[model samples]
Target: MTPSRRAVLAAGATAMAAPALAADPVSLARDERHWARVAALFDSPPPGVIQLENGQFGAMTRATRAAYEQKLARVNRETTLYTRRGALQDVQAVRAKAAAFLGVDVDEIAFTRGGTESMLVLIGGYSRLKPGNAVLYADLDYDSMQVGMESLARLRGVRVVRFALPEPATRQRLIDAYEQALKANPDVRMMLLTHLSHRTGLIPPVKEITALAKARGVDVLLDCGHALGQTEFSLRDMGVEFAGLNLHKWIGSPLGVGLVYIRRDRIRDIEISILAEPSDAIDARVHTGTVSYASVLTVADAFDAHAAIGPAAKARRLQFLRDRWAETLRDHPRIQVLTPPDPSLHAGITSFRITGQTSLGQALELKKTLFERHGIFTVERPGAAKGACIRVSPSFVNTVDHMDALVAALKEIAA
Candidate 1:
């Protein structure tokens, strides 16, 4: 009998893992030696360009990329046979692996194309809203999600409430704002919560805010696209029943892999978006037609690489990198670090705008200058109260030296 394509791909993936297994396990402490070994697992960015824009899309590990390529080749060769017969078990296995990683039941997880799709499905298919009912979202939520909520309100004839979080926000202030909003809008049926803000890298007090929303009989949808792999926390800890996560962001999987978690009991509250093949299974909630099978298959490989380094270690490394650069620029006169100095409120991502650069164009110009003059790569994020800013996010693959270089560049730019 001819060996199945999936078997071939799995064997190749196993071969790709040998190098990772041979390396010393990453340490939780800030040991440069251990981290340098881990950094070798990823493809380096172009020479002389320090990449601080990992929040846009994470770079895939060498092992996972090889595995993805093998899977893609197999799928291309086998075509329908791979999709119809060979892919089912592989996909289910990946789902089981993801469920285990997330600390949730298999039935509660549904694979989607990416975070945007998962969020749009949840926000659009939510069954609890009606005319005169209200939905709430903050200014810091992802632009795509915010647009989805607005459309949802318009289509369902529901009131949409938008709020702006304070710039130098504290935990107490954030909680108070949410509590006051819920109290003011007694008709609010649902609220969208971003576990981590992409603009300023603000880590909101999710568990506390979710509890407040629950007591007011409001359902919360958590956008954990940036939070999951960057930080070590499980859905159970978040205390929210619905969430959308991106495997590609911090998990280092291939692009276009994400999942939605619906609590087993609360699954019924979300209407199924795909009507053709109606079923009560969690996957029925979102319809994704003919997605890249190879991308989904590689998630298990990414998880394996992530596990070898340890999620706790990865979180610490990211936090350490953020602080390495942030600490140096905190006192600079011309720099305004938008992310709070509070350690609990931030992680790998942080943003800074030059004192006089406030608009989008100014922010873009600053990013360009950093790249052309200093050989550093950063991104401009708009929507902050003061103005647009440059977001700096370091991944596990980044080194302490890279961050040091970033600090030097920032200092030069400030001068």
Candidate 2:
């Protein structure tokens, strides 16, 4: 089979420049040409600014950006004539591509506006839990899930039990905590698991967790917004009841695309979020009307770029950057690294609580300081009441030198 245009270009770029990447523990600065192409993906990145926030949103790859632009222009040109029939076909093509990437039946995958929408639809569709019933979640799961659960708890008269894992965790420890939580709340009909925790950068053992939940007669809904392209997993293997994730975070797609996977058997169990006549498809959580067609269609290129990097290579590259920065900052007196040192516990995202600072205050200061003094840009833990923390995520396009410069800047700031 002939190589894809993206594959050829990525391979060529990887070969041409690798010094900063090769010499350092983390490397995104391989070749100037590749870096330039990668950098161009961000619409308004400051000159010399180093972005370590891929967990929030990733800049689209050149392929993805170009594809979006081309399709967008075409859509604009045909605005008057762009029929729902034609757009639906395009969405179907994108759906098939997304399904292939996720290793599921195309009929099993439904598109949503983003992670928030996906979760809301799931929460609403799951009418099985009543007021006396309970829905279990973790303290570290994305705040959006917490909000969704809260709203549903109020509407359905269900109890929402928010569980917390012990800090500086391990796989076994996390499992034990979850088991205990579930045991205490035996009436729980639904459980939410995060493949990766946004707060602590801890990735739970999804398969094991889901298996345990299933054995106990509980349905699992995985908040995979931080997990999808950042880490690789097959839905079939994980054995979760449903999984929903955003494409914008790690997949390098446009902002609005998200995916919700409804297990084949459970599709009939939940009601559709939007009123729609019965459909033949097994997956039907996609209930919103008039979605951004271009945004959803743009999801394919994110998969393509991810595939071009190859899953293993991308995993290694993300770990490299994360470990590089974490290992570097471990010795600093003021930094309390929250992400596990164990590679299994983290991927591209790392978070730490710094000494003697409030999260929001520190965030504001750092945001201003980095931009004004060092040309770096990052978000601080604005809501961390326990302490101030900074979260960093580096993609394959970020070189080791970027990590080094970031560390140097941090050291200077600390001093």
Residues 1-415 of candidate 2 have per-residue lDDT tens digits of 1237545544543442343234442344233444445444445555577877667777786666767776777688887477455887888998999888888888887888777677767776786887688999887877778888877777889988987776768889988988999999998989888888777677888888899888898899888888887777888888876877788888878988788888777787678546677764644556776777777777876676666544555566677777777889988997777777777788878877556765577667876787679876666764333555677777755777788987888788877
User: Which tens-of-lDDT digit does each residue in 37-100 have in candidate 1?
Assistant: 6777677787877888899778887767777888998999999988999798999999999999
Task: Name the best candidate (by TM-score).
Answer: 1
What candidate 2 gets wrong by more than 4 Å, as runs, is 1-44, 279-284, 356-359, 382-388
Q: Give per-model TM-scores.
A: 0.92, 0.87
Clashes of each: 0, 10
Question: If candidate 1 were superposed on the true structure by all CA atoms, what would the RMSD be?
Answer: 3.8
What do the candidate models score in CA lDDT, each in turn? Answer: 0.85, 0.74
Alpha-carbon RMSD, candidate 2: 4.5
Residues forming the 10-long window of minimal summed lDDT in candidate 2: 16-25
Error of 2 at 147 (Å): 0.8
